[model samples]
Target: MKRLTIAPDERRHIERLVDDVLAEHGHWDPVQFVTQAKTVAESLPLRVRQFFRQIQSEESDVAVLSGLPLSPDLDATPTGWDMAQKTGAGRREEVVLALCSAALGEPFAWGNQQDGRIVHDVCPTPGMERSETSGSSTAPLSLHTEDAFHQCRCDYVALFCLRNPERVGTTVVRADRLDLPAPLSGILAEKRFRHRPDQSHVGPHGHSADVADLDAIMFGPPGSCYLRIDFDDTFAADEDDHAARDAIKELYRHMCDAVERVVLEPGDAIFLDNYRVVHGRDPFEPRYDGKDRWLKRVNLIRDIRRVFLSTGVRSRVIS
Candidate 1:
């Protein structure tokens, strides 16, 4: 896997973007900041465009980028539009929003987490179950795509740490580092694996048991490849797709041994090319005694048309 380190000059550029955003609207209302950031990003320069393109290409395989200034008021979770108005780090949202907007050429929203229900499909546990008791144990999460069931996958998924776990909740990312054998490659190329959405979320309404083409190669771009995987062992496909599914399972099993794990500390933010890498977390005992592990997450869809905004699908703000 190729490593892309953030050069001092590039880091300075990121800092400048953050500073500019905060300086202009740090004191504004959260709603107003969101609106202004959108306006500013729409007219970003060509150099910024090139910078993001470079980031996408170079960091396709490397999953972690360290060394960014931590906001002094970083909290356990991000304050929503309403809550942000009353917090010291309210401006931090604007700063992060601006940085991601410049980096991905698309606007982003704060992931809403209300009463332990996070909006995005984050695994509270490996089993996808919320803690039955206030004192339940946390398991090590396996590497998988953020949302494999969605038709329009986010171009990038980022997690910014507000607090680290007491024990071990190290993030593990696997890329092309795990080599797939010929048999597995042939099975995947044949496109035989099928995946169904976990029944938990789909059961409330009339969601169907839609199965994904698991054998399909996760990445599509020319220069580099990304991955989208479902780590739950219970996710099974049809009999005909069994061989291909087995091949994928075998590859993933190998990945368990080949992962380059990193334990993220406070203020660390990890951005993953959602299309290229599979990420997971090591299990840790969450001491629910007020200091449980907490990280703020954001998902972004890169504008394929940053260089040509009128060509692709128009960006929409998810409410």
Candidate 2:
């Protein structure tokens, strides 16, 4: 993981930039701001710009920027993403993330998730404590590649910490760190796995029919490979292919063995390379006293054209 700490002066510069953004746009509409964000991001502090440039150039597995400016009068953690959206809580933080994320790649969203909001609120909800989505508090979110089912899944998953009284840990497993046997690696390289859209993407219309595409669990070169698998949603393409099933089980074991934990503090934002890292969260009890763990998340793709071509429209939100 690569890390950078923003100096006091840099933080102040960022705050000014954020203020200018909020002042110009009255409402926090990232969809409208995205095209402008890239231009705005060019004005970020030199060190900060260099940091993100290094991350992109090196394809860093996990990178973090610390000491970002948080709002002094920040609102309480919303009960869920819906509550945050309704109240527009943490709007400034959303701009902070969007601007910083723009330094790396183009931000995008899913129409089926969080009402197509470019930046999503990740906080525990009352009844969804045990669910598989980000709202879950009690269940240990299984480490998986973000949006593993989608062809245009983000190249990076940026998460900004707002509040975390419990100091919950964000778990990660790096693909480059795994050292599997040649036999197992060979099996995973084959196209024997199917990735299904996670819980967050399934809307009232139900799961998309095209999610059953067969793909390899690991891809790219031999030593440094990219991963795409969800423990809950990915399965062997052929039920009768016991070898494929066994390979997935073996890969899961390797993933568990290679797990690493990162505890993010307020004002710290972590950008996980979706292709190189699988991330999850450790289970923690939610107090629901408006002080529960809260985070802002955004998905970034290397190029916006992929989304435009996929949707057959020049929009960031994928329907």
Candidate 3:
């Protein structure tokens, strides 16, 4: 009933469109995927189309579309990135996510993450069961803007669910929703914060980008503040780092009071405006018996020129 939901007819139509695309391509190809998905999204039912466009100006940090068809015989949750791309085709849920991503901008992947594969599997990995990365299941992931430490991080991030046996929820916190206290707000506005890149970019298969300090947490057009931060990776350079630790503590306090958790079903996909909000996942038991929760993730930048300008490389990855 809410804007975050999808109607039965809309879902069916989306599936039909996805079928049309797969009939020719038969696989998930990023370049062709966006062109076709855009057309399908534009032709979606008025309600759904309206919701899709809301990513451009919506006050809510996250927009979700549900009820698209999901196959019961979906492949076993992928253990890693290679398996994810190898098995990502023909899923209307992926098409739905691609469509939403195209509406905002071009979908891109980080070379440092998931082996630079276009599609990423967010499943509980065997050894990473307790880490903070997407593969972890036992620990509650802290809030973060995906790739917040990067200068060319995406403008939007979307997660499409293929399985969720545990129904574990993702937590969201909106920067616009909070009325920050004067001191904390002032500190956050200062160019005193330092955020390290997430683990996805720190490992051996990680990016070559330098880990540097962030100038400010909130900055954008007037009346529209975009936030970039990570609870696990960002830290103060020193105790005199503009009360950085205290500033983080204050944000955590606010988040504790105003967090919203959404449990995505099999047919649901949520597109988050990365610049407007931060997201994390709740702790869940990993049933590595091939039925654990799983999701597909992709990042989108509103402008392609930003990517080129940031790294001087015209490729999708900044690292």
Residue 77, candidate 3: how far off, in angstroms? 1.8
131, model 3: CA deviation in Å? 1.4
How well is each residue in 1-319 modelled by candidate 2, as lDDT tens digits? 9999999999999999999999999977889999999999999999999999999988899999999999999999999999999999999999999999999999999888999999999999999999999999999999899989889899999999999888999999999899999999889999988988899988784357757788998898755689998999999998999999999999999999999999999999999999999999999999998989999999999999999998799999888
| Model 2 pairs in collision | none
Residue-level lDDT tens digits of model 3 in 1-319:
1246677787777777767767767755765565455566676677776776665765556777777567657777777556666666335556666766676667777777877755567888878878879998889888999888877788878888888988899999887778888888788887777777777788776643445654788777778888988888777666576577789888888977878898999878788889888999999988776677988777888787797787687666655
Between candidates 2 and 3, which one is better according to lDDT?
2
lDDT of each: 0.50, 0.94, 0.76
Q: Give the clashing residue pairs of candidate 3, or none.
A: none
- The parts of candidate 3 lying over 4 Å away from their true place are 35-40, 86-92
Per-candidate TM-scores read: 0.68, 0.98, 0.90
Per-residue alpha-carbon lDDT of candidate 1 for residues 104-199, written as tens digits (9 for 90 to 100): 534343222222122122223323223321112364565666555444446676665555656345445556575777677555555454444433
Candidate order by lDDT, highest to lowest? 2, 3, 1
Off by over 4 Å in 2: 205-207
Candidate 1 lDDT (Cα, whole model)?
A: 0.50
Backbone clashes in each candidate structure, one number apiece? 4, 0, 0
